[model samples]
Target: MVEQIVEVEAEAVAPIVFWSTENQPERAERTKGIIEGFTAETGIPVELVLVDENNIDSIMAANFAAGTLPDVAFFPLDFAAGWYAEGILDASAASSVVEALDATTFSEGSLALVDTPDGPTAVPSDGWGQFIVYRTDLFEELGLEPPTDFESIRTAAEALEEAGFIGIMSGTDPGQVFTQQTFEHFALANGVSLTDADGNVTLNTPEMVEVLDYYSKLMAEVGPKDTATFWDQSRALYFAGDVGMTVWSPFILDEMAGLRDSVLPSCDECADDPAFIAKNSAFVPAFSGPSGSEAQYGQVSYLGITTGANTEAAQTFVEYWLSDGYLDWLGVAAEGKFPMRRGTTENSTEYIDGWGNLEVGVDRRAPLSDFYSEEVLENIIQGANNIDRWGFTEGQGQLVSAIYSELVIPQAIADIIDGFLTPEDAAVQIQEQVEEIQAALATEE
Candidate 1:
């Protein structure tokens, strides 16, 4: 009877459910380590669910309708804004958490992105910087200038293609969110906002049409045979010496350094040492479009505490997640997780400096500085502040989430590539679809 009573009490206790895209793949091992450590020290029970970014939109939607939202969810700020509008997020709790942790430690850009008249919509955690990476060796050999603008990139890609290698590779697969992300990276460079500040549809504008034309023509002419390559595939192809350039996130840098242990370094010069990729590649933190304005895409990750949950336990989890357990958590993808909150309560630059010093994955654990210079790290830090995202500039976050769920932009780009429509017609259809999604979101509000 005594044992039975203990079992009953334990079963009755609520588990702090959490969700994250980081809970899977190569990062999974490191994630498990941190979560286990958090539970061991704090005695807080957690139930973590892993969701891929590609499918998170649908899964989150279903969870939202069923009221099965996790106690804590790792999501991008724009997506979190939609949940806030639906009353599924607690802005008060988020603000309180940020205050308790001392928000000044965070990067200024991240705070600006999350700040709202009502308070922050999400607790800023970290950021992933995206940019175009190319083979410096090839560019030097061919006497090609760096791909700093749309025209220069085109010129370089064509020249590289003539040399029997594709010019560039990126996320072109519609089934993956990377496709939309890749499209947005280029589109944002051209100043394509999916909607205006008044929630007006703006995807069919002349700028958007030009951007799509550039993307489609580039894919059709210079991309890999599968042009549908997502992040991993694109990264792998570039690493394999199959392509001259790629647009990717910082997460791939360690793997490029030969640290991850999953795939052997495939670049031609990497045969003798896996670190060859780190030695030969060039980084471009931002690029310009025909508009003459340069922009870098930033994905700011956040940890949100949901409504109607174990408040104390959730707050404890958030505190631990941001401070004590932060290094272990970010180290899972340490290369990509540029800390949003710069330091712990202990020291101002402690965490940020530690992040930069974390070793890249080579045959042995070696700091990235061993393979590259301070300029590479500086470029990454600079890119973190030049965030370019749609909907944040306008109040159309709900529409952003809706478009993501519907994959509106990806489908339109696919139509144009498949010979079904011209860029102008495709832009019209995309605008109509986005307008419909906007109307539906407004009705829900």
Candidate 2:
């Protein structure tokens, strides 16, 4: 009787590799927790590997070469298009994942950015919308108010500079983050449109030159000496109290918090604490430009599943991540890292209270409600999707690396800002370089 029973052991499920930037440990940790929870609930054991930002591309490439890419992977928006084009990804399968998204709940712009001709490549996870951050307390102390438009921003910059503070912290690095912050704002302020109705490249237009001129003059007046270096360098100067204002996104808030917690304990110990610094800080919205309206924007990154992922599993993960429960957790873990879904953001008293308490202008603050809404979000998504729809074609990455990153941008920035060349000369050089890149890309195509 004791000798009767036989049992079979369950096979172990393979681990899932997750590639994420170093910028988001909180989101990554939360995601890992969620995956673990899913496995516990369903007995679908999956290990999550957190890849460093530097090694992600190479690792993925090696995996592809070896025919062992992760069962599921999260890719940055910039790299997703190339991955999709290389037959390394299967967009058709990804579409099924998109179909399962809670469309109405997501920001329309965010959703739109991820949509592709082949299908939806990724899910919209977070965004970086530009806002002019100034010192509210400083404004009050200087007997000034928050600037309403570009003219006022200029006036404030001048006043701040005279008062012994650099007016703005701007960087001229060719990386998309720095360039977008500087270029898009300037172009949009001057009404320059980057893409036409049919999505063609319009970088060399007169509007773009005007925008660049405005940017050059503005930077000359208030920007840090080495602005052409990198955004992080500029941010470091700002946080160290070397500058009075800057154009920034939610990441700035996180940086400010870290500074308070680590760098200046006295400032942290003050009654107002973060609120005091934040009060010193105010946010300005995008201004109207000449060719286009001033409210110009662009996309930063997107989250999407790997093409070969299990559709059902990917859907469940995306849905869960976008759900109220997960977003609430994210708000706590990552603070302003990810924008909340519409309903949750609207009804949630916490978000309203948090944003309301900030020193941002009332109008600029009001749009925080619509930040995750369908309309504004859609514009961003569409704009990014249009980048590809326009002239950025296959092999454009290499072209971007060589021309924009390695040559034109660096030369232009140095020429215009460092007095090496005049703005007019720099503009002409930039145009010529762009033309060469376009010609080469056209030939390759």
Candidate 3:
């Protein structure tokens, strides 16, 4: 008998490094657990590095220069496309994972957020839409419709104030990014785009002026007097049932249900039941204004594979994460981490259904469904379908990043509220300033 030589490709055994921007101790621990499960299932080791979100850009830059980038990273949506543009991301690795998982299973909004001509710059993991959580009981008592648009919101705020409740609470801290986020939700509702189809700055348009005027008036007339209220103030006041409505992220869902001890409800009704406010509240995920269609400001996080990564290993890891380990990943912060992948082709709503049942909250645990009605939960899910952002879909993520970094919109809103600048003046100033920034960016290229 003649002996025949047989050869087989060896499986990759190289350990991959995974960087995460979720540096909070507890969040980091949860991520580590997910990584461990991935390792055990595939025999592929991963090193989890917790990095401060603030330092991500600088650290990634240094790693790029040194040619020592990690295999994969869990980063904010803001950096994904920009990094891919800089050639620091391995698009092939992420694309392969998306293909393997079946692209149709993911959220359309999430995928579109990071899309490029080549493919998705990164794989979207999860996200939450900014919410207008309101007093459903109060609206019912006054015979008011849900606040689905600017006119309705304004009417509701005025009526609620007359009924002895603070009308609305929104972030006004000029120096904080929360203020930008809060204002962006209203700006988007008013059909304000940072740039036109040709990438020309259009911040001075009538629609933006109307948005500024409306927002400033609402905050001045019925909002808190301090003019510096942020997320904490708004959330606390709403939980106390002293405010008619407040702008917040879905993370407030678990807290409103009295899931987290540190931020339990304090309303008078809560004396009888901790979830009183939750039972009385309703959420408006997206709203519209006269000049605009309905929309919501969504924030999504992405999993990016680095350029120098062990591509095969990184791809496998990401696929595992979005498949067998996806629910566990979303469970860490279920309220905020809405699943990007809805489910497999065979079970379209599997992940969404699983996500709804995952326990959320710190100190104590309960599924959001326990405190919210099925209709309310479905409302939140539907909101994700309307997620929109300025400049992102227009291939201007870099400019969007610059706008946030400079806090231009927040300052403009602050000036309007402070009486230092008229809405028209703020619009002109914003247009000029953003145009200047856009010009400078153009020169760099």
Query: Which candidate leads in TM-score?
Result: 3
> Native-vs-model 3 lDDT?
0.86
Which residue pairs come into collision in candidate 1?
A: 105-342, 259-361
Backbone clashes (count) for model 1: 2
- Evaluate residue 397 in candidate 1 and report its C-alpha lDDT on the 0 to 100 scale: 65
Candidate 2 weakest ten by summed lDDT: 1-10
TM-score to native of every candidate shown: 0.87, 0.76, 0.95
Q: Is candidate 1 or candidate 3 better by lDDT?
A: 3
lDDT of candidate 2 over 302-354, digit per residue (tens): 55566556655555555555553344334432323344234343454333233
Per-residue alpha-carbon lDDT of model 1 for 1-445, expressed as tens digits? Answer: 0000001112344678777777455566566666777777877767767777656666776777887777887887767777777677787888888889987877777877766776787788889778888888889988899998899899999999998888998766766778888888898899887777666778888899899899988987887545467887788888898788998888778888887678666876788888887788888878889963888877998988877557678778888988888877777667778888888667987777777777656345666677777888877876875677877756566777677778887877777777788999988998888888777777876
Worst 10 residues of 1 by lDDT: 1-10
Q: Stretches of candidate 2 above 4 Å error?
A: 1-11, 22-28, 141-145, 173-180, 195-200, 226-229, 257-260, 263-275, 296-300, 340-407, 438-445
Model 1 CA lDDT for position 355: 76
| Clashes per model (N, Cα, C within 3 A) | 2, 16, 0
